[model samples]
Target: MNYFGIIRPAMVTCLMLMLYLAIVVVSLITGPSGLDPQLLSGFSLSPVTGDSEMANVIVTWLLLPRTLMALLCGAALGAAGVLIQGATRNPFASPATLGVNAGAMLAIVLGSVFLPQFTGQFPVVVAFSGAILTTILVFRLAQAISDSPVNLVLIGMAMTLSLGALSAGMLMFYENRLDGLYTWGAGNLSQFDYQPIQRSWPIIGMLTALALLFARRLDMIELGTEQAESLGVNVRRTVGLSLLIAVLLSSTVVSQVGMISFVGLIAPHIARGLGCRKVWLRLLVSTAVGALLLLVADVAARLIPLLISDSHYSFPAGVMTTVVGAPFMLFLLTQRKRVSALATTPGETGIQALFHLSPVTFLSALAFVFLLIFGFSLFGNLDLQWINLRWPRVLSAAFAGAALGVSGLVLQTLTRNPLSSPDVSGLTTTGVLFVVLGLVLFPGLGSLEMTLLSIMGSGFALLLLLGLSRLTGFNPLLFALAGLCLSAMAATLISMVLVLGSNQSSEVLVWLSGSTYAVTSERFYLLFISVLAVLPLLFAMWRRLDILQLGEYLPSLLGVRIQATVAILLVMVALLSAVSVAAVGGISFIGLMAPHICRVTGLSSHRHLIPATAMMGSILLVGSDWLSRTVIAPFEIPSGLLVSGAGGIYFILLLLSGKYIQRR
Candidate 1:
């Protein structure tokens, strides 16, 4: 009767274990065939031969491995989250946020495409190698910029986007050979045998053990580096080793289960909330929590069809995790007391002073555009028929890119954050999500219908982002973080829709990847009209943007209506982004890159910046479209993927340059 205080931790652990066991049972019995009473009786280690043989086989070979894999992967990811957060002294750190998962995914895709023999035999090794390399790259870049948590996460996100785009490009190129990988890429837990589970569990266990061994050191390190070093803990060594173990654990799971988002992130918080204070206890609780979360998600993934009679597709467990986990991430952001904000006048004076306006630069940009146009027009042959086919795509790319450029410029000025862009701010992805949903619901949605859906989605996303970030006064880094969460959710929803709409999946995938393959004169005209319609409104706001750049307080003092101006600018951005995305799918980075390119060229005036950015964006996308068509010839890469890959690299470089680093 007096055991409550004496065995609280044990009691909690036991309760969680019981819950996990119940869920495991549910997972076993719930699936397409529904609950089988025979499974309960016939479930045995050894093969059963009788009326219950089928149940025994299903339980033994199918359900057991899948259920066990989910448990093990969740435990590993949860432990990895604890290790990473402990090492970084930042609660936001996780494998998915730190580029580890993306790197592992890219490695697997590369191995599958280039070295199938080796990759097939040693997928874990490939994933680990990729994870380690990307982790190193992210850490190095983040350290070089600043030691802020926001910087680390932003740099990690940059690398993740770049790696993800590269992986997508490869997947698109080799879709025929890697047909089944699309589902696996979304994080599947289906298993026919125990081989993968057997291979993964031992490695996960060993790495997790190593992580637990560092518990005391991590606890000390969390006290602060100076104190930890004074206490005889090699702070650097502990952090590095902890991160290494985290990567190993995460990569091990990814190698088996593909990319499961947010388990690592969600579990540690749950453990802490459950009153696990000490590092060791927290790690253990986090392990349990992660397992429970993943198991529950997997069970939900399995039970959806049973619960919904018309549902035919079983969504990947990863999508379910994101559906649940993204909100958690946003909640964490809202709880933060302070987030690093970008400097009000980001490179306004310094950039302008360092690089004055040069006609040569402008002329060079123009020449490049003309050159790309020439190449596009005459790349394959000098035939008029080829010219007629290529012109619409080239023009569509130019108009869409211009719209994105102006949109990005407006957003950057509005938020006073150099990193603000339609794609990064969730506008493009949300727009694409709605467009895809429309396609799924209506199947043959016309241009006007798609554009309307895109506009509605983008507007909703903008409002949601603005509302969520308002809690922190719209701090730039937190705003970006919030947008990233929205983007992830939209992407997961898009994936689910694509999975469910199998008939339109391929076509939608191509469009979602930002293809210009289907561009025609009609589509080109729609893009042109949309871009032209928005340009005048944007130009009229240039003066407001310039004044707003001086900072919100100054702008208000100067009689500028900050809220009204921002509201107007955001509506314009949403419109531009919606139209562009409708025309070219969810192309990323043009909005981010074009305006930055303009700033780098010493054009600080909004008047000049807006036009120059539009032109630069047009040049960039037109050039990308040309490369997409010519690089692999008959098989084209998606222009959006190309821009994303290039833009990701640029973003990392921008961080490395320390241009965006604002010292608190």
Candidate 2:
């Protein structure tokens, strides 16, 4: 390396170390109890003696431990980030992006709920187990989808959402029992004593050292598997070791600190941006940078309580990380040097090519739908009389699923990208956010009023996605990134509202989870009528969709009103998405899955694709709803979760099939 390269990185590292120390001092002095300037006068004496005794007590018991824990956790995260980014060969890779933190949080929450005794004592083990499982799942899914960074991150995002939903559902279900879990879930850095620090530091120190040992191998692996292998590196073992170290470091912090967001992601990136590309130097700089970033965030978390004048409203340090991290992620997305387009083959075909849907097949599909409705509605019910009352539930599931399926089909067609869907494109989250906003701003707002706001929100989100995609050239990865960013923003907004409006949050949570249990006749008709009117309109525009499918320029050459046609269809998608969100509360992936399945089955024509997708969607959601109701009988799970989880898995399968992997 050049002298300047070494000197520059070393200088940055030193500066960062100094900055971290400065923050540590600041954190040590400031607390809920005001800092005393006179405490500095007693530096000559023992810490526990002299005029600084009270100051020593405050620093020793409270600030000292918390600050130390932050430093340790931040350093671990920074090292883990470098390891993950190196192992994945993706600059964007981090603990959060790989679903490690979410997985760890899920395990921790579940343990606290079901295995309370063991969790309180062995949280780190439980957390590590969860993180390991999640890491494996993410890697498996990424392997299936292609080792492309975008694909891995996409799968990771799906995993994060699925795991997060599971955690949220569990927490909501046991809301009464899990009193302190919420604050912990948000990742508080407050320390009553030094127990966490005492228990945590040794493990962190060892892991950091282990990570450094892997630095040279990681650098080789970054050269590509073939190159690394040629250079006498065992690529698989290195990757495995790297991932294990990364997961352990990250999960350890999560176990102790709840969930510190973005430290892993930003630390390594900042180090690399500052010209620290050599593995060892980058690791050191990243560690210091992470410590500084987190210490600053913790300080802000402490000071914000003072600014707000409400100690009860103290912002969790984790929340602040996300607040900073999300926009940074978005900026990184826009900065991606290149992205591969989804693969296209002439005359695409799916399972439908093997078995033609004759009149009998149509009848069979219809019979199956009715049977699903019956199975979901009447099966195992002690009260047969209540079968009549279940029609609303059945209809609600069918209507919402059908709407989402058709919406997904419309989005895929309009975008000419199979990965495009209402949920993935962010319409569903936007709609849910709008409804939540309505509920917060107007507590007495009826379903009708909320539905209107949802439609507006979905439309706005769609427009925003389109605008951003225009800038990104409609690259599927960028599109998904935009959607994820929008979703995160919406989720953050919902979290804030929930924290502020604690009393009514449960009702909002239920709606966001996409439950069918609350389907009243009014809501049922609203969704049912909306689907009935829109499905036929969708059919009428099938020819236009087909024409547009020929390519944008060709369609215009063929006299298709491209702009007006796209605008109308997209509006229809927004409407359908809003209706589904209104009825089922952000049911996702159904819109992505149903149409994808149909297209894979060789139904390429819009005529076949749209209706087939709608039918499949109806089946998927009805079945999901059935599972939701019966999975833990008498206590329903949200159909949305089942659909989202299944769809995410199916999407991964498609990626794993190797057809989607673009050769450079």
Candidate 3:
């Protein structure tokens, strides 16, 4: 290797080692007052004697395990990221991307609620099993639709959301266990029980070792399966082995550390960029980097003083990653060379041959709408009888869904990427956080303030996103990727509001699942105002949105003021999205699904698609909400989870089927 490569690897390794030592030191140093035997006395000055009696006792009994858990868990994640990315041959890949973490988390949450017995005996086992099953299902579903690896990941994502909803449904039935579920969901290291370590090591070790051994082959796979096969590599075996490795590696890590984000997503990429291409180097470098990053992140999670001059400032490490990692990922996407993410539909089927109503689409959609209304009737606590106001719930759901549908449609059109929606873009999460923060800081900010602040936050996030793209010279695909990361981060940071909040916050989490729950007349009025506002703007720029989808140069050549048009459209989206988030907490997949359904069904024209999407969105939240509440009679699933369950699966189906292959 060249001097730069050699020096770079060494530098990172040294830094990682230093951080590792630092973690050991910190863990050894800090503890509760009366816990350590030697430190219990409050002072000590003997080498082995006092250290062992006090710090060692604390370390061995307390911090040692935590530190080791951090190291091992982080290492496993780093390796897993490399394995999955190499296998999928996509840069924008993560376990979360395929819904593995979401599904596993959902399962864990449900188990805590419905199957508390399992939580005691086989929590990790159940989580691993759930993750493995979902991964396989997503893989199979994707392969069945389209055998492309990238599409497989997308399908896997769909599976994640689908399973996530089912898991949510289970949680809804067992809301008594909601507190524990949320705590576990954060991937916190506070669960320092030692038995989990024994249960965990065997699986993590085997998979990580296997991955390391086959790291060279993985690098080959990264080179391109066809090319690797040309060089006498068994493409099928390599792919299988790589995927199996990923499953085991990730599952093992989840079983222990819960689900830490971005370690797997970013570690390997950074490792390779730092010149760890060879299996041995990549494995070691990634492990080192992972350990270092997680340790620091853990420390950051603990140490970053919430200096909010505001009333209640709370922070969590998991949230920190999203806040930090989201922007970092975006920056990475910006810095890296941009590639066309415009995957076209395969087989040259235009609106002519493939103009079908999206298989299982209409039924699923209608059923979802009907069930949401039905659900509204069942759920009641004290004076709150959900079933009584079915019409109001439907009305509320309709407006919220319409707003999201319009938001997603505009995002897709302006960005020209089907995946470009508020949820994916972090716009919704940012707006919601703004609302929550406002509530936290200044107690009685009326609904108007909430709406206005939501709009402002969304606008700021959008502006930063657009400006960042320009500064970094990133393409649309990368820009969207960055947005997703930021959104993920925002979601993480904002979750603290739920976790640390009083009963009111708990109510928000339960109700925010994109369902038609408690919508009164006033909220509907605001939503109506949002709808009317967007309509006129959309009407004026009818044709331009269509051409914008063609690409950057084509629209500009067609006399479109791309920048000005995009900015105006973004303002409309923010107004709509702010209204949506304010009305119905942050929902996922509706925007993505509506547009996809329209496109797949040959309703590509902006004129028809926009209105149709509005209808689709309205139908979706209402139907989904109905089913969510009525599914189990007494308890109700949130509309968000229900939609994610079904819609997520359908999304994966599209991804795997190569439905968008060259079709964009």
Candidate 4:
């Protein structure tokens, strides 16, 4: 018997199946109430028939439903992963990456809010529709952009963040109505009945059957559309059907079990790594792998509360997946070969042919900013208290936005990476985490101490990212990916602190969401000074930045002290990012968005680009702050949320326009 040969096909499959079944049994045994033998008996064909009502209740009501749900959701996501990967021929594609999970979650929330009477299948249908729509939107956006597989994921991420913000806003607006939704949105797996399993299983089973039925066609489609068409495949129909089924499966799981993050992504990759090349085998193996992975995560989620002896701390299963999956995603990114030329450069002639800023245009923009900052008010009547209150908030927004804009401009130019920004570069996130950690550890840490701590953290993060880039042979994508991973880790830490800490402070919540509500005149003064100090140094180095943009080798050959230049600029970025984090608490991507917008709006040179981007940033943030205040008056959304949601959409539009895709 050739264990490695095709005839016998190895014993790995049988072993894996046994392992999965074992895990299922283990999951059933472990619960909030611990293992019960009579519970097992209750689940068996014959009822316990003894004084085992408690055991029967636990099995019938709680343990059986959730364990079964974990298996079903995991299997569904796994099958969805195979279909998505096959359809797109992109290894990184998944429900989370394609914005399907976010869209479905949003749909469920809306359905719950609007159609309270519609139950059972209504949310599933709405979620499925949302997922399909998001998929189509992402596909169209990616098509409009460059053909790089990476673009699909980027656009999807932007869409995901935007949709997430919208859903969060909805949840906030109706928090009383949807009281337990916050926990559920984080992906809870608690089941009091067998309804979710009963509802989700049929849809998942049908999707799995469809995947197996269309396996050959999907396999052919992976060989490129032209080749597939040549091989007598209706390429478009096959691709569309595969994606539709994939989204349906994914959205169904989300509707039933909340937002499980990465099972879909990790499963198919594991199957392929294990040499499951044939489509049917891969689909089955992926499904099994996903089911097993999620079952373990769900078990861990259940056990966490027990371990901590705090049942109030209901750690969602999705957070467990994220804790594992985020690092896995980072590992996959680290494995990519060094690939540079990720940043788009404006043509030399375009940069050289600089236009002077028109006085009228400048003042007009300034006037617009003034009107937005001062003219708008939610409270109809203004008084001395209002004047004092409003100005500081407005100034805080402006200064933070300007700092972000300048930080982004410098980081992008220095790294020569369009994707570089305070948030995406991991600066703001690290800074926020460091400050939050300081709050947890020191207990009585002052605002000033927190600011200094965050600044140091931002500096450390920048240095660490630089070190990673150097080790990775300066691959822009690798730098971006590493930064993204760091950011995810920081975000996870923040979430843990928010959920688990004793304080559970509303002030901290406001800060984490990037609110200006907590910004005092004192804080505004600190931020203003920081911005003023940073801008001058940035202006002085603007010409050097322009010279350096002519490729790395040329700058050094042209007598530029490349190392000194990068160090100084990075310090500047760190300082600016730290201040914004201090003031606004992770107002992200303004740096990414503002500089890109400046270039598109004809401010390509560093001289014009730096100041123009700063001005634009101020306008952007202030306007966002105004909108945040006014959008649903009396119940304000965070300025950070508004900025991020709007900026993410704008960045996607930029990608769709083929503006940011660099031709190397």
Candidate 5:
């Protein structure tokens, strides 16, 4: 309304745009060629005269294509985000929410794994298909449930997780085929020919036209469905059009670049803050902001190593954007209390009973999971029909499953966050890194030492989570965003270590997925001790945890030392997570879904929730392991990957069934 407001936002927009362009220029110059800064600066003034073929090729071919690709992809994603959050009125919505990215990922993964001949061109088509399917799934799922903007978002998240897991598992089934897909999954924008963007440009253009045409409807609808309807807007038709355009704009971009996080969340908010009022202005501003944000992230991804000599770091644009966007969003959330996304409410109070076990049913379910796991493990690539039966293999799968199951229980109990899991939190991966570091630094160290180091990593991760929670108000969605960011960071670091030109450390990647390749009686004994130790501790703290779950204040009045109890439980969770990580690889999401399964099965009490979560986790891991090993014999998938695949479905099912509202 004020002159200063108009001038300030315009100035900020101009400044950010200028800064973004400069970064792109800088990123275009930086690469793995080890080009010195002086040479690049010199080359800038020098026109294309291919005198030095290598330098010319690097600059003209590689750098130029890459930079342009980054700019386009970034802008597309950023605009996509703005369209989504604005259209849905949910901050949590992103390309990933609507399944666009994951569906695209699934298509690309399938191309690599199942259809090798089409690897080059198939990824794009597959990605497009995935994105389209994703939009349909999200809208349909939301329609089937409630059409509240928040419910659509939750459905999108559910679809995303399910599809993403399916994609990962598909890749695993064809890892030998899809070995180098992680970078693509990381949102690599290395090689592009401008053809794909051109193909989708028409769609993007149509979307822009629609957004502008329906600008007034958008402004009216943002008020609320009923309000818009009262104002003579055809709320249903306008929303349907908005949803269609948003999905098309989003998925088309996702088809090119794998899912880039936070672009959508950051862009529109920035655009509006910068004084864009009209729906068309917001969309346009968001488009420019999104493009610049992505370009800057890509450029920075390239620029970081140049700034630091001897640095060997590289990040995909998507990961880098998320890493930057998550904290900024958190800061924004804290500074302003009023929000558009789903709001959290404290849970209802009651005397939640712990005992919900029916001996006949519990045992029956256990038997079923056991029999299925046993049948699969007992008859894998390692045959045993005429030969003597191996007790070790059977026991190994069982124990590992049990470890995960229990780990999930411990984590869910500690956090009181349903989506909380060792896998979801990235503790499993971080813990693995630490354990590996310990093993490498102190050769021939005991299992206990490795486990201890891993627990330290897990504790460090939990502390990081706590600090993040404190800063971000501990919203589950934000926590998930942080976890995604952290996962990318850990993956980037791991990729660096794995490719360090040595087979010795490289081999540890086997455990990156849940595996029992070197299982021993001693290892099992340690796991047994860990499970026994943590179970009783969790049980002891049951009442306090229940009280703590009753929102943050009431526990203190119940004569509980809230801070101390939380600290201890947090440490215990780290211990449990670290031990599991040491035993298996960095499988995530089991902890998140296990607790939900428990709660859904009518065991909300900590006492029952704890044990139930562990059992559900065990069942999931064991079952996934069985599928991994048996379904595709002689080509074993990682147990963790498979569990994630399964758990992703369970997560989606929770959304479809409305169990998500309880957690939400």
Candidate 6:
């Protein structure tokens, strides 16, 4: 049949196959140093010497296997994406989005760290188990709430963050044991031989075939559950089987390549856009598209070094895919038809009755803060030398945390989204990215300069997000998705910098994970002044913020200049987040957690909630700082990492409780 009366399906298929073959040939001929002339000579197993032998070895052992592995893994991920998206009836669904890849990677990291021998023995089993279990958990939790596609993705995102935090923490603490694993974790496809391909292809092939067999059922189910049931399809059974196949396929790929993202997500969309309507046809096209996409990405990864004249530095193909895919996701969000279809129900006004903060509760919070400060100050040694070194660190964490908390509250109020925060909104990542870029481009920048760069980056990111989100009238889900895309792109760029063998990789990693170790007196003072500067403005806007929470219409009716107020508040958030990130790296979730915690305590008035949130944030981070310093003693963990772990768990629980309350 002709597609759109412009192209034939068979012709499209043939074109895709031909393109794939051409790219495969290109991949084989290419290397870090470019094309090899000797590769034109016929293959020889003879004991040839010099260029021919070197070329033969590189082609046969390294380039060929890596290329083939990329094709196989890409095909597997593509098929898996189609399966999950079909089963969930969610266009945004993919193995990465559903937490399968993160789960698998986390499990493998845990096994390798805690049970090295066992992990070394049966790595595949461990990966598969993690992927399946996490998928089940995400699905169950999402099901518990509602079957809204948006909710499923949100829950999956939370799980992915939680799992990722655990994986990062383990790798950081056990860096000695997991050396070079970070490169692999970032998704490496380099191969020394064919063993990985030899072992994994069969499983990948079998899983893809099984997924295809369910294509008809998936198509029926897409007609709606009742319609599918009437058509004699066992909807639940089909979904379960499809998900299982998807997890297995994805985990198999992860076990070999370690978290290649967005292949599954990008491939199916490309196939469908090419007018592949039938489920089976779409699956076939998607698999081919996925393989081709990954092969091209690998080629780009190899060629990047040549482009930059930096032959010594190269990064993972996964980074290349992410850099490409993130923008594509934003493009998808901009499509009016897709945005309308994914439109979410308005968020409920949770816990209407606000209780007064009792004196005991206020005093208890104060006591906790003082105790944490004191403990953090005197935990190791009480000498003057120790105090001189330690006080800066403690105050830095406190001030930075308070800034983040207040920033988060402002963001939530302005966006009218409870989940809104600097980190979640991509402001933190953008700020961190700019600071890292500044450090790379112009090393030895002072604290003030770095903070300026950070604010500039964050403000730019906010403007970009707001511009794109305007197309959808600032719908909360779409806004969040846009921020997510921005964050992913920023993060991928940072990873590219890290993988380029930067001299500051070690320090950057530590700081990126939210270490307070390097915070000096000067840096602490800079953060203190920035936070203090923003407070008076925040206090003046408290009434305006409260009016905003009642929605934009009411605020405008009340004679509040809504646009000016929101613009100013957003600027404050960017400044606050920027300074905090400059001081302590990307300490996340404090902004998210602190605001929610304050709201839960019955403080709805911005007058009361603002300081409460700031206090809560300070206590949380100071306590995290104390634990980070004390837990491993001489070996300090990044306080940001610990907070992220706790925050991820808290975020998930918060989602569940909110859903339950809404149901009630």
Compare the candidates by TM-score and give the number of the best one: 6
Candidate 2 lDDT over residue span 431-526, tens digit each: 998898788767877768877989999989988878877666666556776777677667666676666566677777776878787777788888
What TM-score would each prediction reach against the true structure?
0.94, 0.85, 0.82, 0.89, 0.82, 0.95
For candidate 3, the per-residue lDDT at 85 reads 72
What tens digits encode model 3's per-residue C-alpha lDDT throughout 307-347? 32222322434455555555666665554343234222232
Estimate, for each residue in 289-369, the C-alpha lDDT of model 1 and write its tens digit.
898899899888777645654465788899999899888888887774534332122233122223566756675666677
> Of 1 and 4, which scores higher on TM-score?
1
Alpha-carbon RMSD to native, per candidate: 2.8, 4.3, 5.4, 3.6, 4.7, 2.4
Better of 2 and 3 by lDDT: 2
Error of 6 at 581 (Å): 0.8
What candidate 1 gets wrong by more than 4 Å, as runs, is 1-4, 7-11, 44-51, 305-312, 338-354, 359-382, 658-664
Ranking by lDDT: 1, 6, 4, 2, 3, 5
What RMSD value applies to candidate 4? 3.6
lDDT of 6 by residue, 339-392 (tens): 676665355434333455764576477667666575755565768888888888
lDDT head-to-head 2 vs 5, winner: 2
lDDT of 3 at 461: 83
Using TM-score as the measure, name the better of candidate 2 and candidate 3.
2
Per-residue lDDT of candidate 5, residues 1-664 (tens digit): 6898678877886887688777766766676744445335435555645444455667666677777777676666666766666567776677755567777777767766667677565555566666777787677766754445544554555466556657766665566767767666867667536566566667676667667787788888889889999999998888667766666666566666676767777887787787777777887878778778777777766655546434455567776776676566545545425333454532431222334666446646756766766666555445555113434434555655555655656555444545555666667767876776665455576767767877888878778877876766665545544554455455555544443323455456667666655555566667678877877877777788778777667888889897688778777777777777766657667776666555554565576656655666666666666666666677677777777676666665655565444422
Clashes of 6: 0
Predict model 3's lDDT versus the native: 0.66
TM-score, candidate 1, is 0.94
Candidate 5 matches the true fold with a TM-score of 0.82
